[model samples]
Target chain A: MGQPKQERAVQTRSALVRAAAEVFDEYGYAGAGINRILKRAGLTAGALYFHFGSKEGLAEAVMNAGQDTVEPLLESRGLQRLVDVTLVWAHRLGVDPLLRAGVELSLGHEDFADGAPFESRRELMAGYLREARDLGELREGVDPEVVARFVVGACTGIQLYSRQVDGRASLPQRVKEMWDCLLPGIAAPGTAQDFDTGVARGERLGRMGAQA
Target chain B: MGQPKQERAVQTRSALVRAAAEVFDEYGYAGAGINRILKRAGLTAGALYFHFGSKEGLAEAVMNAGQDTVEPLLESRGLQRLVDVTLVWAHRLGVDPLLRAGVELSLGHEDFADGAPFESRRELMAGYLREARDLGELREGVDPEVVARFVVGACTGIQLYSRQVDGRASLPQRVKEMWDCLLPGIAAPGTAQDFDTGVARGERLGRMGAQA
Candidate 1:
């Protein structure tokens, strides 16, 4: 294919993935069909199959296609970075289809094993927690790996409930409240004071989010 | 028409519901079939239909048939009740088919509107939190309703992940870890010290479980 066609194909694939995410996020994997996705993307059947051979393939791409909606707040690191990452992700969970769909697809699908990156996120959290512990930031007797998994689970439960109750309009606030309630136990005394455990804090970081 | 026949009918219905929960928990509502549930229950199609008219009805019954595996810890109350309730529920989520199935059914089904008693659980938690606040057990400026909902969401996410990763064998520890991280932010200063916040705490509570 020519250069223009190659570019067009890529754009079409991206569009389909985005559209598929929206459909799957709303209807889940079982209910999501190629027809609705194509309709949403304003493309033809040939376009979808050309990019993703099947609905499962499209879902797999969507599941793995996590992109940072905004660049991190440069000032944050360690335990604070973990908090910022979650808060920002919560905010985006309200507005971002790809991320939200990945969560929905992962939790709702019964047999789809490659659905959610449960481990990758856990590892990322553990790494930050370890740094926090090493730097004398974390409270004594906390296991980074255990707490990381616990955090991931809590976030998962919160998002699922939030989505069910209100389409996640309240997620950022809920996440902030979560941090407000949780950080005191995990962070060393007086260490969590510097962190702003508020939805506004996350939204500010989101607005300041720049492409990496 | 006889009493013995009615009692036998009750036994069969209980067996069918248990079998259905296991199946629904494994395959979800969309994937669960009447044939498999019947096989698990060792009943005929007629027996299943006689007890639960449809798969949807069976799922609804499974979701509503929640039973607490442990009595509330007597040593815990106020802010501690919130911790015990969550931890106890977490331990049960690992062992109790009814509760675990309820979690699975509620999270997996899309548009199964009469699903998971998420609001009910939040209300229950909020009610407890309100008492905690009235007793001066909660931190200053904390809203029970908001915190209750947030706690529910966090638990929902954690349980979903736990079920997927392990047969929820780590649920008690995970729930305890969650309490360790959260209580500091919600409870009054030094109030959380009374709570054990450990897997053994949940296990001990489980041992004293009684039918209410």
Candidate 2:
């Protein structure tokens, strides 16, 4: 196919995923209708099937796309920073149907046999925790896996709660407060004080690890 | 009209709720069929409707029942202890269909009506945070509402993650670790150490203005 044709195909697929996310967020996985998704995407059923094999396939694609957007924020900043960033991202993204859809998609996967399609998201978070631990940001004898789980759990809780409360509290500020409470217990005794100095100085700790 | 008839009606309704929870947990809110629930409860369709009115009504009943079980735990322990106890309760409950149903019901509400259903849960948590602050368990200047949100968020996150990981980690140990991290940020300076010491002395802090 020529470049123009390829570009159009890619655009159509992207639009479908975006539309699918909105429908899924509003109606959930079971309630979401494939016909509605196709209509919203400005495509027909045949075209959607051509791009994604079935409704489940489309849901998975939408989930995968959201993870792509969220995973990097977790990786680059490390888990702690990821928590902070996600709160800000959630607040900024709140009320936008697409982001809301992404959150619902992520949460709804809890019971899947392959175990939450956001498996990559968990792995990425685990990796950041390992990195954080190796750098001595985590306390001596603290289990990185355990801490990682806690961090992930806390973030999930914050996102859900913030989305529920919406205007009453700032999501970003709530995220920071959570991190502050959590860091002191998990951080090597002295590192907890670093955040007290401010976020910029705290960011430097990620680079100045024991290996550095 | 007789006492026996009233008793039988109550029993039948309870059986239907229990059966509905199991079906809902297995198939999700939208996926669970009323017929299946009726079959499992060994009741006719008329009986089910007489009890719950509709599928949404049935879901609300399931939620109300779970909340009834959960409310006392919240009232007695306040927030921090509630997290600790819930992990224990989940472990004790094991893979019981009822607990699984409760989790599914919660996930189903993810997209429902923005956020009203969660308000009671949020309020119970906030009440604990206020109590903690009054007892000098939390920092003097921290907002009780904000701290409560974080605690709730962390708990929600941990429950979802732990349920996913299943045998990979001990839920109670994970809960302790979360508390370890979170307590420091919220506790009044040096109060955590005192609180830790006080626990051994059996000097529990009285409940804060929790009802508010």
Candidate 3:
């Protein structure tokens, strides 16, 4: 329990989460064996037990960390900010193991330590949609909470399909097309015309986010 | 083969497919055991191999059959028919084990027979959208293929979320909400005004499709 020992335990826990995320991302929860996770972390059984009681515990820890890693970027306002958040998240999915694995785990239909692994993503996006509504950025008929749920489902599905199809090489375009297909219905007339849905927008935003 | 033997083989194959679908649906591809599939079918290894070469082969057969079970619901015209197709399919996802198992396999992120399990569904929806475009049923500036892909992704993700959160009992409403959010952007002006996206529509159409 000394300061140095405590620091080392924290580092060890982080490593375990990262390694578990990789294995889960690649092989899924059912396929990700505890033996493989231990081997990947280079930790002994005693050490793993001290940190996480079981595979389910490890998965929950990873999900919590991944959700934190995906905290919304920038302090910008309006519906464009919502679009930016989604696009940047998509770009990050291909590059960030924690996130990619977190998403994989979320879709597995399991209950994580933090209620549902994806509940935060849904709530956060819903908050943004509510803001957009308050600002008159949304179309007259659109319901912010309902539209927010659509966004969550759409992004989740897009990423799942992209991963299954091609390791997400086409995610940027798919994200853009998703917006292109959706904005016309929900955005205030003519306001979404200038918003960037291109791959480049996400790449740039993601890069900025990492530095920030 | 003799005529009676061929008929028996056909019966055995149908039985195997049904049993495999149930196993695969409940346990996923990786978790589905060959022993369990055989036990469920009440068949020997020789009988299984005679129809499907291996577990992979069996999964492929299940996926192909699932896709077929999901054939477009109505031959009606316009975007409303597109809406009907989506709604009917959502209702079926809960009631049909084959479709459910096939979807589980497709989302398993593996290579099954024919190609990726979801490719044909996307292509078929895209084909429908193209026809809608040619018939002037699409809104100006909307791209049919792009919308089709969104539809596929949205539906896939919604079904997944619904399954995890509520055993897919909420699928009909989710599908309805999905269309409510997307149609304003894609449907022809004044055309989507009266389309029914309620669960009742799906239930009614699904019953009709079954009777037909």
Candidate 4:
């Protein structure tokens, strides 16, 4: 018996997203071609149009899909949770084509300026840093807003460097190093020892994500 | 009397580099075209071929040109010098087209992986941090190599964020903020007060560059 139509449609949509992601990852947004994406997906142009409507639509789908990975970490809080978020996201950025493409598009494409999550990510980080401050995990005089922006920028630079240096294979390790250098500046005295800045921390989260 | 052949050739080469920088800045490396670059420069194909040989060759010229802006910072030393380097470069990256294009090309072009200055920039930063370590300007436990890599990544991230969020008009200010957040982490307790993280520190350097 054939798969149900709804189930088959869902599969097709996912397959198209994956294929588009690979193309975007390799060629970037301006260079990516719809024909190439369709060929990779082994789907008709009609299917792509029916699902994503346009190449821009498909690109937006890939960008949005990258955010779905964040759902699993919502249970955690404070500075350690912030570290977990960066670590897990770095690990996924190394392994996931959709996330990688989303980052490339978000960072480099001027037309998609509003779509980039620099503001939202900074706000999320600020929220976590606020929690850390309330819990007395942060050092005195450290502003959550300021520190949040710095962390966002630092994580971005680390990933960009790792990506260029070794295709992001070292992102988690670099992020670990970043936290090591930064934690002492932001965390309260004696509290710096409480947070784990290990690559395994991210790997464990990845495993948890898979199990769920 | 006409200009010397050498002087004319030099002018042609610099003009071509500037025009190419503008094109690459807007369209990126892959999206950039030789014809468009030639049009922007108002030069024929033969002139481009004579000067830079190929598009890739021209890109190398642009990348190398970005390093020219660093020459002025070499006379300073230790932690303050390291801060100066980032601040000055951030200021340049905000206003200079050649430097801006060089960074854009260096960060995003996969084929140019070996060409990106990730390792070299990190090494240069390490060298400065080593000077800081020798001068006892760093915190006792802070490793220069680790801190160097982190600083490079953080500066890169700060510049990238500044570029995306506001076209880098605020880069020097952001760099100062970065040093404000980071100095406590790396510098010795009494030494963080010695370094200047002001935007004026960079603007003064920019003015000196112009005068020179």
| Model 3 / residue A179 / CA error / Å | 0.8
What are the per-model DockQ values? Answer: 0.61, 0.49, 0.53, 0.61
- Give the TM-score comparing model 4 with the true structure, all chains together: 0.92
Error of 1 at B164 (Å): 1.9
Distance from true position, residue A101, model 1, in Å?
Answer: 1.6
Q: If scored against the real structure, what TM-score would every candidate get?
A: 0.86, 0.74, 0.91, 0.92
Docking class of 2: acceptable
Better of 1 and 4 by TM-score: 4
Tens digits of lDDT, candidate 2, B85-180: 444444433444665576556654654535554566667678777776666566656777776667666766776766666642455555666765
Q: Rank the candidates by DockQ, best first.
A: 4, 1, 3, 2
When summed lDDT is taken over every stretch of 10 residues in candidate 2 chain B, the lowest stretch is B200-209
Candidate 2, number of clashes = 3
- Residue A184 of model 2, lDDT score: 66
Clashing pairs in 1: A71-A210, A153-B158, A156-B157, A157-B153, A157-B156, A157-B157, A158-B153
- lDDT, model 4: 0.83
Scanning candidate 3 chain A in windows of ten residues, the lowest lDDT window is: A109-118
Q: Tell me how far candidate 4 lies from the true structure as C-alpha RMSD in angstroms.
A: 2.4
Please write out the lDDT profile of model 1 over residues A1-212, one tens digit for every residue: 55798788888888998899999877768778889999999999998777888888888889877556563344777888889888889877776779888877676665565324787789888988998888888888778887898888888878777777777877787788777777777888777677777787777777666343
Q: Write the per-residue lDDT of candidate 4 for residues A1-212, one digit (tens) a residue.
A: 99999999999999999999999998888788889999999999999999989998898898877773654544777998998899888877867788888888778776666625787889988999999999888888999999888888888888788777777888888898888888877889667768998999888786666566
lDDT digits (tens) for residues B1-212 of candidate 4:
99999999999999999999999988888889999999999999999999989998999898877774555535789898888888888877767888889888788776566625878888888988999999989887888988888888788887788777887887888888888788877788756668888998887886666566
